[model samples]
Target: MKLHELHINDFKFFSQVEGDSPLLKIDGNHLLVYGENGSGKSTIYWALYTLLECSFKKSDDEVRKYFKKTGDESLVNIHATGTNNTYVKTILKDALGNPKTYRVSRKSSDMSIRANTDIRESNMASDFINYRVLFKLHSSKHSNKNNLWNWFLEEVFPYVKKSSDPCLIEFEALKEGPTKFLDLNGNQLFPTASLQDAPSDEEKIFYRNYRDYKQKWVTWHFWLETFLTNITTRANDLINHDFKYNFKIGLNIIKKFPTFQATDDKIKWTDPEIIISITEYEGIQNPAIKKPHTFLNEAKWSAIGLSLRFAILETRLYTADLKILVIDDMILSLDMCNRDVLLDIILNNYVNDYQIILLTHDRFFYELAKSKIAQNGIANWKYLEMFEDSSGTFPKPLIIEKTNQISKVWQLYHGKEFSMAANCLRKATEKLCNAYLSRQERINVNYSVKNLHEMLEAFRTKGMANGLNQNNLIKLIEYKNRILNPSSHYDIETPLFETELKRAIETIEALSIEANINV
Candidate 1:
């Protein structure tokens, strides 16, 4: 299914964005959202989550608590007046191009919104992922154990429960065996001494039941081990695949790959737990670590968590026709290089098969990803910029086609958009300065500085003693002082002429070249 549009009314920051004013206008199945922190990016994220996951089925109190603002159970917009209804609407196009509209709306008097259809049994909800969920998996939080188990059972062994095949029938018989040997008073019954011995009717009945129960128990035991063996084999296979894939993608940081072992007391087949342990070889191998949360670093643990999530989706009980992957700022902890690797894997392996809604607050990563998506020739992807106003969070299509910083600056300049051009120029200079300082190994350079002038000055001081070109550095500083700084900070009665803008652009381009940066 492809989401064509989303409408949110009186939900969180959105008061009434609908019709042509949809919060999201999806082109194809992929959406790329760029928003600053606290601009209601997460609001849209949760909105889509609630809509697709059918979270409207939750109790009014539960839903309110989730969408609460300032500790109050108020999902309605703060600006909304009395008795205004809040709702989220989604328009989806199925594989055959049939459009279906689903809406969940709650009135002021109602506790929970009503949905048109029930999707509680749908597995699409499990595909929604964000950093908080990833962190829980990374830390091996106790609350997520049940979730993990259910995911495995439902996604991996979905048919096991429905099948009445011989093996399952035998398992049921084994499960029911213990009850059959007990008497009416819940006491154990025994058989007669010999087959020739004449037994009373009650004793004969008891003997028959006992024999049948024993046979069932024996059969069950025979199948129990096979069942356990099958589960263990599949679990190990999944783990090995996950480990190998993550390692290949440069996400795993451990020296040893981990394998899974399903364990339970020999007699307790009803409840078993999956334990992950490092694979050992020879006597010089790494110690066996059962809990990755304790042994693995944050990055490695994160990779493992992501790998597990992907593996579960890949092995889903249903086909991939309607799967949607919602990734919400899951790469905050990863460095830029690993982030790129993660993106590559997602785009190549999952994007075509599943609809993806990728949201990020990191501007650099956002730009890099936009370029990558374009390069991959994904025509259906939509790039949007999200921001907030007095009305609420809004999304507008980002139509500008420039992929790189310097190119964007030039595009704005040539279009006679001088103010925006100056802004882009300042950002370009900041990026180049930071990159140059980092390359020079200037540990003392302040990376946190937001002011362009200060960043440039710091770079000049720390980089001049190094191999930085002095002439280019001076030229950059002079241009910043003469044009970029004033154009960004203060209003001038006269606009910058085309010639002046061209001069500033030339200086920036020359400095970038001298600093060995591609514009």
Candidate 2:
């Protein structure tokens, strides 16, 4: 399953003024978003995050608090009044071709998520990573060794389960105090009296329970050791092959023994910790690095943190209908080369398995990634931009989804606006031609005065000489003659047919591919 649509109203920077706010039509395709800082880019990330998180809440009030008008965690727009209803809704579709709608609002929480296994499973299957998540990985002080105990407890352990038993979860077991003694029948067992005064059977049960409690810790320690070993191998592979780094990550689990009280009422223990070290290789010789955070630059630290999280995510994604990878400017610290390498991994490796929602604030990286997507011929992707709009009494997000001319043409065509569609197609064709001429540096002062006919002739001559497809060039000529020339140049009353306009729009799209046009 995949997210088909996302609609936001009176939430954060999104304001609904008589339904003027636009709904993002994902149509189950991947999304690439570029927004300026403070432009409501992260709002999209949080919106999806909040929706899925609601599926894990036990009470309606837990979900309703976020949409209420007054709360520390409320996401309602500041400009919203009590009358304004803040909500987020999404449509999900699967391969069977049925769309299921899930909504989160003040009143909709009564519908209950606990009964719906799909929502809960999707929440588990998806992964959300941002810069803040990466920050948590390498933010320890220079003197202090990096220990990811709390991070793993809060983030990683909840999603990962034991290979021996899929139902046994680390975080859940820890939360319920698995170190507490239990009988053979899985009932909680407590000592009744001291060993000297107790009956023989009671004393035997106490000894058995004590031994079992200690054995539980040993079992947990073994499981953790195995998990860390797997993570180390996977992280090293990614660092070596994908990041092209000459370093390997080493992990060691610091186990804490649980202390039992004489009353058998309270069990206390410190959380287990994970110590991270690094091994640098220079010409097949390994060098020990005890303090990786202090020794490594921000780029390497970021890469290590990212690799570890990705390796953990690989182990967590078991089975679910909907899986999404939402990244919010997670590569800001990496240089251009590492950033491109990460993008290549996302596009080449994970694109098929997950519905990707990548949000970035860098314009250059946005354009670069967009060109790469086009060059790869990935048709099932949507590019969007977000900017803060302060035209009203309060700031709002001005999201532009179809910035490209070709996308605009399709938007108009689907709305049954033939004349506007025709005009957009013509402009898109002109833009393609102008791009080619500009790249070849063939435009003179007279190029400004040329019309569509002249531009097409020049493009066909130069494009064919440069190995452009002749068939598409011929199609463009035919389209220009049938629709573009008469309606645009002569101001003639040409009745536009739907089929003819659709074909013309498609011809322009094909010509763009043939000419390798991207801007």
Candidate 3:
């Protein structure tokens, strides 16, 4: 289930926060979260984790260290001195086509959790997937056989197999290579083929430990038991979940250039460009591998240097279409060309998903996502900035002073024409908002305010529909790529100043006049 509106209160780093996780209502996809450092970007992720009661390997220390509240009376923390309870509310649409709003309070003590799962919205989309967020920070939830795993599991690790739906993949071994593959049922994965070589130490240890892991046991390992069953069921349920997740393309050098294999190289260049092709793809099965049949490399992790050079690699995998992916501090070792390739994947190939949340301190990428959204429209994103506050606390999220990346870009321009450029663009945005409002006034919808965010939700809806002009979309894409590849045209002192200045003035005037009529 995708979250619509979220409210975080009294959580570590976040004293209070609220925002509409605005979505492309028509498809209920492409949600843009706008925030800067410490503004509660991670908090939003945590709120879900807390509600799901998901455990993690690192969660034990993090919760005791940060999630613990400040002199929180609601929390009874005998061990940690600073423990506070945070109230997290998430608006979700459940399976069985029901709108649901879930809220729960989290404390240092696991026993103090409370959840409200019945506040389902009357209206919900038909394809909304039922997702039970069962996460444990630094917890053993996934290790148990019968417990929960991450929300996406369809077509995941081939070992995982399930036939209830097309998406669920049970993890039974296909080839009995050295290690035996066990299915969810008490059956061997493959026809028990004999292996030529003996298993390695790590493999033996894993086999021994995983073999006895009581995934569904409700005994001493009660939490693990529940966690295992929960994940198994959820993963199976999402197999046929309506909205599938996938990436449009994977990482590679071809991404840097729209054309194929323009870069000349032999070994590293052979690496195929990866696209998260959806269930809707009409192209060949393997977009990256040009040869007849391809082999998937399941070897050990390669050095970061080599991996970065390889073309088209999927960093993560999922059963459904992955609309929004959050990559934190990755791609540090990539060269300029590789970096460009990655950004290109995010922008052009990954077109189906509207919103992309890339967590990077790299100013280059931040602007890239912003530029795309700005060129597209503010409705396409919410720029969330996270940072630490006065107390040097864990971190607090800072609200993006500038909603659209255009304004942010304007503020960043320091060269001769840069300052003036932002002013001109600012004027253009003001005009568009007015035009959008005016256009939205004429359309009407039969749905109530239930899923439709507001009494005037249809206005925003219609505006969004009308604002998505073919020409505008293409132009904005060019603008976004311009920021990424600063060619001669993007020269700060370019000769387009006069035309730009005139356009800004005309747009501002036209918008002002139009807004007056709307008023």
- The model with the greatest TM-score is 2
Model 3, 18-113: lDDT tens per residue? 343421121233433433444444554444434443222134443334344444423222323443344555555433445555444544454222
Put down candidate 1 lDDT per residue, 333-448, tens digits, no spaces.
67565577668767877886777888888888888888898899876777665543322134322223334678877766655556667777878887787787654443335644
| Ordered list by TM-score, greatest first | 2, 1, 3
Q: lDDT tens digits, residues 1-519, model 2?
A: 888889888888777644523368888999999888988898889888888778767688888888898989899888899587787878888878798887778876435653467777777778888877566655553447668676676556655656523223443454344334444556664432243354555345566445555576688788789898998899888888898888887888887776554545656767778887765564344466657778888777777777877887787655777899899998776787778887887888788888999999998988888988988887789888776665457777766676678886776666555665677688898898888875434454755556787788888888789888787787788888766754553432244477778888887888787778852
Q: Which candidate leads the pack in lDDT?
A: 2
Question: Runs in model 2 with CA error above 4 Å?
Answer: 17-22, 108-110, 141-143, 154-217, 263-267, 283-286, 403-519
Rate residue 285 of model 2 by lDDT.
45
lDDT, residue 195, candidate 2: 34
Candidates 2 and 3: which is better by TM-score? 2
Q: Between the candidate structures 2 and 3, which one is better when assessed by lDDT?
A: 2
lDDT assessment of candidate 1 = 0.56
Pick the winner on lDDT between candidates 1 and 2: 2
